[model samples]
Target: MYIFRLAFIEAQLTDAFIQFKNHYGFEVQVCNPRKGNEKGSVENKVGYIRYNFFTTSPVMNSYEDFTETLRVQLEKDRQRLHYEKEVLIEDLWNEEKKYLLELPVEDYPVFKEIEAKVNKYNEAKLDNTLIHIPKASNYPFIYFIVTWDKYKAVSPDGEILFEDFRPYMNKKRAIPWISIFKDWIRKPRAVSYSRYKKYLPGRINEYLLVEDLVVRKERLIEIVNLLVTHDIKRINEDFYDLITGNNENPFGLDWNEYDALAPTGGEQS
Candidate 1:
């Protein structure tokens, strides 16, 4: 049977139509406008149908779906109406059907596929942008598949994350300690001395200058790193041994007392 189709030129429907023509070997007519009267017949029929049927339909949902349903209903109208030639519309359709084109088995316009990962923060990491998933609790993880254009991110459960693309790596997590130390070093001695005065013991306050604050902070960082890597018990024992000057008795003295009293536990009591 003859089938009529309408689509926008920007949509590139011509290629699809041509593929149908090549496969079916039928007499295909493309109703595209070059200048005038190109779409006049289509436009007039569209308006007439809309005004006659669509305006009267009480249960129409969407304009597009309503128009499609109207087209099908018009076929029934054509069958009932008597033409000047006394030929039925269904009879006309039967004659036209023989010369109509057939569609291909294979679907056209292949789509591109891309890979993406979800990070610990539950944000979809696509390319560079971190996309936040709405109602994220429904999904098992933060990962998503991004379309080729990176316009959309589909979560594990097929929920779409709209136009939110950003850098994949987390800058805050990777803060440069060297740069931070350099900035601290450039600050005024008085500012540093005032900031760390609480860490120094009452007697050691007079001995610690601004330079000592930097040294103490660096040592604390090292000690903390070791404590985290090894064990708290080992660190406390080592600190006590360093402070008490008795290598054999590891936990002989208080760790906090050593931290407060001595700049470096090497200083003699």
Candidate 2:
């Protein structure tokens, strides 16, 4: 059995590291925080592995594929006789295997807890998803427990309120217009302070920054309806067309249609 040092992680352990240690049954010998002598083994071994096995990087399809490559390489390397003892390395491992502790009964669940704050709308935003917390207007702060696969929002008293699977990798994720529309319709001023609006085109962002609430709300409604299909990139082109006063309307609705409708209702025609 190998004597494991907790210093491999850090001198002062974090909560996550403590859980990792308990799960793996690692020996807890912590060294001086930045001492070179104590960190020598960890640093040298990593460099040795990188130079010896990874001189030519291997192309891997997935994590499983990479793991299988490592396992096969290790088994094959063990077939050779030991450099010092001159006995088969595999035989040495076989004799030493009995002293190793058994694996843990249950696999360690990988997750982290983060402190989150609720917006005025009683919603907690994580990435692009907004989780609604009903009757939580007064409760501004909460805990977000997240794993690679899922996340759950917990109240101060440790109640799991909202839980959902997280997107693995949304490289080009777009905030849907529907989610934006319902929220922004109430508060036009909030648009200038929005984090998501930064992603919109400079022209659209500039257009939305107006003192007229009526005009702002109307333009936002039109923009949201234009983006109803959620083709943000294409809709952005449409927005540029409107700003540039082009004849081609990508949304297929005349900008003056609202004025016409208002005039018709004036005469009750």
Q: How many clashing pairs per prediction, in order? A: 4, 0
lDDT of 2 at 261: 17
- What are the per-residue Cα lDDT tens digits for candidate 2 across 1-269? 99977644446678888998889897888777567899897998788678877989887865567789988987887898887899998999999998999989887888888887888766786766665554344577988788875677788888877666554423233344455555677888778786556665544565566678887898788777766653555654455464335556533544442221111110000
- lDDT by residue (1-269, candidate 1, tens digit) is 99989766652457757765566666655555575477687888788777877675457554457668867888777775444667887887788889776666764443344445544333444555444444443455534443332345455665664443233322222212222223334442442434233433332332223256665455444443543443433444454443334365433323454344433221111
Best of the candidates, lDDT = 2
lDDT of 2: 0.66
Task: Tell me the lDDT of model 1 at 159.
Answer: 63
TM-score of each: 0.30, 0.45
